[model samples]
Target: IKDFLIKNKITFIEDETNNNEKFTRNRIRKNIIPVLNASIAGGLGKFKRFFENTDSVLMLFDFLIEDRLNIMKSKNPIILDISKILYYNNKLRKNLLYYILSKNLFVDSSLIESIDRVISSKRPNIIFKEKGMIIEKSYNDLKIEREAGDEFDKEDFLKPGMETLFNGYTLKITKTVFIESLLKKKNVFVFPLSAGRRFKIRTLQTSDSFVPFGMNKEKKVSRFLMDNKISLSERRRVPLILNEKDEILAVGSLRRTGLYRMKKQKGCLCIYVGKN
Candidate 1:
């Protein structure tokens, strides 16, 4: 390449660091590799061929892994169906695990091994946390979640406007005349304005209980969440809307109090939970 460049009058600047013996690459090229080439039969050529073959195998492995991942497609938490990969050989399984986890965490061989063990165990619910990331196995689904930036209890006053809450959710509190419009939306909850605009948003509590929108009997907030299939990590981030007396008016985007549901046309407050 250098001879061809010189013959063609193609000017190029060389990095002097390439020749510096203090660097590991330079030391290997200057000292160790020449000795190996002289003592062994086609040592450098054999090493080059080994790497080329390894690269080709890896390319094929990547293609196969990508096809499998597309079939197991899921949302934000990167859920994988255990059944899909349960029958795979060890090498392919580990490769797929590394691919899925490498996006958010530094996936080493040991980490991959640990994940493999979890899969083999077949525990209904198993959680492994490392470096601010959580990998949870629940029945057939393996979920990967990043720990929230601020996992502490997030609370705010629900005023008559828009505000941000836990996990970048938009909490919009406004008075709307069209009761039918707000009724159609799942995240939007309506309450009588005469009930007084004194709602506040806070994290869940163990003893929290509320009468769900359609139910006459009161239910435990924790039980409600479990029934609704809310994960343990997600329960912490769910905002509980309350009045001045600390009565639970709503449980995040899940449920609201039936005691407060109003059908009045004129004056009603709309509390909308929206994603950014």
Candidate 2:
């Protein structure tokens, strides 16, 4: 390219740093390239061919990994069965982990090794936290999630028939005379009519404690979240439904407080949780 440009008498600006030996890249280009070419026949051509082949292999590897991830995603969007990673060779396994995690955070070899160790342990409810990201393994399932950070502190109040958005979830409270027996607890919270029609929607707190729905004994909110396999950072984002007294009525789309359990009631208060 340089010879062609000179032969045509074309003028082009050049960066002066290319000739500076103080930089490692400049030293490699000015010093190492000539030495390698002089030491072996067709050395430059060989090196170029090697790099081209390596890039092709890497592209194919990435495609295969992506195909596997897409199949896993089709089964479940949140939790992934990562046990299959154990079947891959160490280098390939680490590279695949790096590829998957790099989508969420800046990952290095050391971080990948640490996560690999955690996965190999096969212990139930193992969690590895680093740089605002949590890599959790619950038996065979894996969860990679970012820490809620300051976003968890954002709170709002919910009223009957009024929809409010909080942390990517849409919540609406309503009083209903008819109780739906098949309500999915993961998306809706049903409480007794006495629990109040209006509630505050906020993330979990350190001091929060309540008797989770279907339980008699009171438990710390932190412990309850951990029991559900929620990581420390993720627990901060789990919405808690509270009444006028600031008492927790439910863990929001999770389990409701036993205090609000409807027992032969004519009507019930329902809070529907949906993703925006």
- C-alpha lDDT score of every prediction, in listed order: 0.71, 0.68
- lDDT: worst 10-residue window of model 1: 62-71
Error of 2 at 157 (Å): 0.6
Per model, how many backbone clashes are there? 0, 0
lDDT of 1 by residue, 1-276 (tens): 889999999999989999976565685577546755554356667665645665444544444445523425564656878876675557767877876555334456887887788888847899988655587889988887655656554666655543444555667677656556678887988888764466677887889999998898999999999999999988888888887778887788877798766765587888778655
Clashing residue pairs for model 2: none
Candidate 2, residues 10-100, lDDT tens digits: the string is: 9988899989765657855775467556643566777656457654445544444555334134221234556666655577668778765
Model 1 scores what on Cα lDDT? 0.71
TM-scores of all candidate predictions against the true structure: 0.44, 0.43
Model 2 — which ten-residue stretch has the worst lDDT? 68-77
Model 2: how far is 257 from its true place, Å?
0.7
